[model samples]
Target: MPLPNGYSINAASSDESEDAERLIETVSVPPQCCSARLNLAVLMFFGFSVVYGLRVNLSVAMVAMVNNTDPKPWENHSVVPAACPRSSGAENTSDTFQQPDGVPQYPWDSETQGWLLGAFFFGYLCTQIPGGYLSGHYGGKLFLGLGVLGTAALTVLTPLAARMGSYWLFALRALEGFGEGVTYPAMMAMWARWAPPLERSRLMTLSGSGGNFGAFLALPLTGYICQALGWPAVFYLFGGAGCLWAVFWFSLVSDDPRTHPRISKEEKDYIINAIGPQGTGHGWSVPVLSMLLSVPLWAIIVTQMCANWSYYTLLTSLPSYMNNILHFDLQSNGFLSALPYLGAWLVSTLSGVVADKLIEKKVLSVTNVRKLFTLIGQILPAVFLVLVSYSGCSHILTVTFLTLSTTIGGTSASGVFINQIDIAPRYAGFLLGITNTFGTIPGIVAPIATGYFTEDNTLAGWRKVFWVSAGIGVCGAIVFTIFGSGELQPWAVTEEERAETDKRRSGSISQ
Candidate 1:
């Protein structure tokens, strides 16, 4: 099927009506090797898994690293703390923080711990734009592989750094963050050379969901590793795994389809044909002024910042909320915190397939599909998040609402999350760098915002946090619905090609 915008996919025409239709032929090659693009997706998946694993392991590992005999700030505030009555099976579940048997635990207070936890974002912010540009100019494979490898090397030194001083560990984590910051944007650069338009959703989702799955695995498993071995082993094992994965990535993946040693010519031809001349670079400088002024670009940016505010708020604060209000113990909190991501991982993977199917069948135009899923991902989650706020101290209701919020949010994998590629395939990485830099604001600010709102740790304060998240999510969805486009932006092309690339159906793909 040929799209007016010049994208062609091996899909059947929409209707069997009066119009003569042709079946787009499929590429049939000798079974000499599995699909290289598919292999790239898998490698990208594990790379993302390692990315998130290293990122979140510290959340769990630090608990064992700290000697927290002091009562929690909320508990110590009132003469008789107002807390939910302990549920059945929650007795003696008051989080008893034991210093890991053999390892030395730090005497750092909560303020110090907070800084340590946030140190990663400091360095993470440094590399976004540079990473995206450099990866595009050069190859993403080097930066992506080196970034992970560097982070792994730093992770191995975490235990040593912690033993030296609080400042040492903080600096080390910041370095690790700087190293890993290239990952998201670099991967986008890689995909620009590889992912076909129809396959974009599934390919991106397959990799993106790895972060969710990584969190699902890391959260609970980190605790288990710490308990069974020692706190140091948590860093050692995950870091080692990252190093091993980097070796495989470097060995197996390449930057461009044209240069891939093992890729089949027939498959490569199909990719080239589907993507056309635009798949390769257009040999023009990026249209910075046009990108700055573009409405759709701003729409996507606003939506990302707002959406990420909601996402990061829950990611960083959910454990504390459960522990404080819902009355789950640390161990239970870890498992429960991980559960939402499990649902998210499953939904993200499935929604991707559904999205591709919808576009292929012409059930909805690509723009509508993006809008529909963004609405589902962003707006619908607001309702459930509100339900979570009102659910009060009910553990079952809160968990259910939160899970519903997260699972529904997974549709973004098909929606605005991947819209960067739709709008600007050539600049997808740079665009992601811009948006994610804004998105990272939430990662830094949300935790701090949640802290400010819930300083008293009252049910009302916690309710405010969820309400704000829901409100931000709603606002983002509204902006995206109004201005977002799946049709490529005019700025994405060279000035010469811009006029010839007449506006595609802004809402639909059909004639």
Candidate 2:
């Protein structure tokens, strides 16, 4: 094929010829519409929403799944009042046969409940690195589509597994987690292909907000579904919705613009110019050992772990707290629990916009911007989390604190979450996999710990949980502020690549 005016194809072998062809094809593409990538971002947004929806439905449904009888001996098990006074037939229900409003409860204790909740993360942690590697090498489209599809399939089978008993249910949930674990890495790979440096915060945050949105919707929706139909319906409904979404995802999405049939040439060119070159020359390999030893990467891993500790604590245990401590009924519990994620979604979206604006205006360097928001997200949440511990039984005050904590933490979507991309776009997927594996540990540990500590289900027990979460968040913020970086690491490129980049810069300067 003919090449650009000054550029010539000099290939010594078939492999070199193939590489040269790809490079020319990337640069020679026609102009494409900007909306092509925007549409990709929108699809990613909804994809994450489905992921969290399937993941979190169990949290709300579990409130009704297990027997939530008071741990205290003095409480009259026979005279169980409705979760709230507004419950229908609260007064008319017979004390002998029915407890309060007649919601079904199981005989499972808090510790068993905790283990069930954490099972998903066990399978989740297993697939991170493999998923990232597959996405980077093969393509993100198939893996991302299959991950959600498999989760949906498992979700639809949850009620049956639960009926088979706790072990069966645990195994099922673990498989579901395994499926969902691939999602973040797959999506990070997609972003590595699609997101331009200046627009990374906004695009990544937009997709990430779907998690908050899913949580916001899933809590209330699961509550109402469990109330009207049964807890099983919550599983059936969300699982079916996830399946439906997978169809669209597989049909509509491509791994990158070059592979997308419908993408305009202009948009393709724009993406290529903005994201820089793709592929490494022969002999270039990811410095996995070096990355493992890097201080900044470890800082990100620590902060992610701490952040998820708070996130998972709230995600898994909030509904229980609302029911036990605050005395919210199933419906009320769902609504109240979902409120903070609503604030988080809104704040996350806004933070992305603000982060992009600040960087575009050159008011702050990328590293400082990441550090600034990381501190805000971590510190403010720590403060509010402690306040939540002291809110007593004042429902309004407690809810306010929880909402404020998540709202502030939402800023991390624009902070450390996107910082990995800034430091190394080529390995963004792998780095996300490494950090998220650590992050999932809190998901596994925090719930079990909370269940152990809050077996009494008292304000005091819950306070201990919040205190631990707050302390972890505070420590992470301090370490990240000192060691975290947004600048691209030298190890990301080899000596040959560095020389080529320097040559390009010198050529541009002379022109």
**Per-model TM-score on C-alpha atoms:** 0.87, 0.87
Clashing pairs in 2: 30-265, 30-266, 31-265, 31-266, 32-265, 32-266, 32-267, 66-106, 67-106
* Candidate 1 wrong stretches, greater than 4 Å: 1-33, 69-82, 87-92, 106-112, 282-284, 495-511
The reply for model 2, stretches above 4 Å from the true place, is 1-34, 69-105, 278-284, 494-497, 504-511
Candidate 2: count of backbone clashes, pairs at least 3 residues apart or interchain: 9
Candidate 2: give its CA RMSD in angstroms: 6.6
What's the lDDT of the predicted structure labeled candidate 1?
A: 0.76
Each prediction's RMSD over C-alphas, in Å, is: 5.0, 6.6
Residue-level lDDT tens digits of model 2 in 1-511: 1133322121111242332232333243333235677777788788888888898889988877775434442273443333322224432111212233644467677789999999999999989877877776666788888898999889999888887889999999999999888888888888878876666788889888999999999999988888788788888888888889888888888888778888877766557565554321112257888898888899899999988999999998998888767767778788889999999999999999899777666677677789988999999999999999998877789999999999889998898877777666677777788888988999999999999988867778889999999999999899889999876666664454455555645787999
The whole-model lDDT of each prediction reads 0.76, 0.78
Q: Give a tens-digit lDDT track for model 1, residues 1-511.
A: 2334343432212233201121122333333236899889888888888888898887766666765433664355453343566556752253554545577877665456556777787788788877887777676899999999999889999989998899999899889989988999899888877887767888889888998888888878876787678779989999999999988998999898889999888777766666544465534367789889989888888999899888877776676676656656556667887888899999999999999777766677677788889989998899999999889778789889899899889998899988888777778888887877777777777777776776555788888899999999999999999999776665665443333223333324555
